[model samples]
Target: MTIRPIVRYPDPRLALPAQPVTVFDDALRDLARDLLETMHAAPGIGITASHIGVSLRVVVLDLDPIDGARTYVNPEIIWASPEMIVHQEGSVSMPGVSDEVRRHARVRISYHDVDGNSHPEESEGLRAVCHQHEIDQLNGLFWIQRLSRLKRERLIKRFEKISRG
Candidate 1:
């Protein structure tokens, strides 16, 4: 598996919604492997196909090293709890910037595995946070947009400063 280059923030491609994965084939499996490699190399808990400029609805997450990586193709959040939870979120595309993001405390998502088999699972806490974050990426909504205008502006400024220095 190759570690693909992650598309950085402010890239117009990152703002566009991802296309759903229709075929479950070797290419899809390879892309999933590549995503896992790239996410692991980024040392990030989660990542999506859109993060690497691939507009496919795929996400890779590894919140627990002991359990290894998990791949999701055409993931869709079918249910979300009314209760909300806040978790510090970051993206491989954004690199150094991170902020708290509020989302449903629990979520049930339906997605396909590497072989295209459908699976639906419920998640909470950090797992739920990762799903929400990656799903937002798939929807073309950067995590920064979840912040207030003032906070978003400040964070962008800080990111620019860090990027320059």
Candidate 2:
């Protein structure tokens, strides 16, 4: 599996909504493997296809904090509990900064497996949070969007300055 370049902030593709995976073929499977490799190389907990310039609703996450990875193809959040939890999150896409964001504590999601079989899973804690975050990326949204408007603006500016350097 090859590591794809991650699209950075300010890229228009980052805001463009991703399309659903239509054909669950070997190509799609390879993409999933590449995503897993990319995430592991980044040492990140999650990654979305949009990050690699693929406009597909696919995400890979490894919240194991031990030894496992989960790949989601066309993942959709089926349910989210009202209970919210805050966590400090960081991203390899944007280094040297972490942000505290409130996320649903529990969520149920349905997606296709590598074999193209559909399955549903319920998650909580970091798994739930990372899944939600990766799902947002599939929808062309970032964790920064959960922050206050002022904070979001500040972050964008900071990233812009950093990119200029």
Residue lDDT tens for model 2, 1-165: 998888776677877789988898999999999999987887787888888888998888887657688889889999999999999876656755677889999999999987789999999989889888888877878778889999888877777777678
What are the clashing pairs of model 2?
Answer: none
The TM-scores of all predictions, comma-separated, are 0.97, 0.91
- Residue pairs clashing, model 1: none
For candidate 2, the 10 contiguous residues with the lowest summed lDDT are 90-99
Off by over 4 Å in 1: none
Candidate 1 residue lDDT tens string, 19-97: 9998899999999899989988997889899999999999999878698889998889999999999988877888898
Query: Model-by-model lDDT, in order?
Result: 0.90, 0.84
Whole-model lDDT, model 1: 0.90
User: Relative to the unseen true structure, what is the C-alpha lDDT of residue 20 in candidate 2, on a scale of 0 to 100?
Assistant: 89
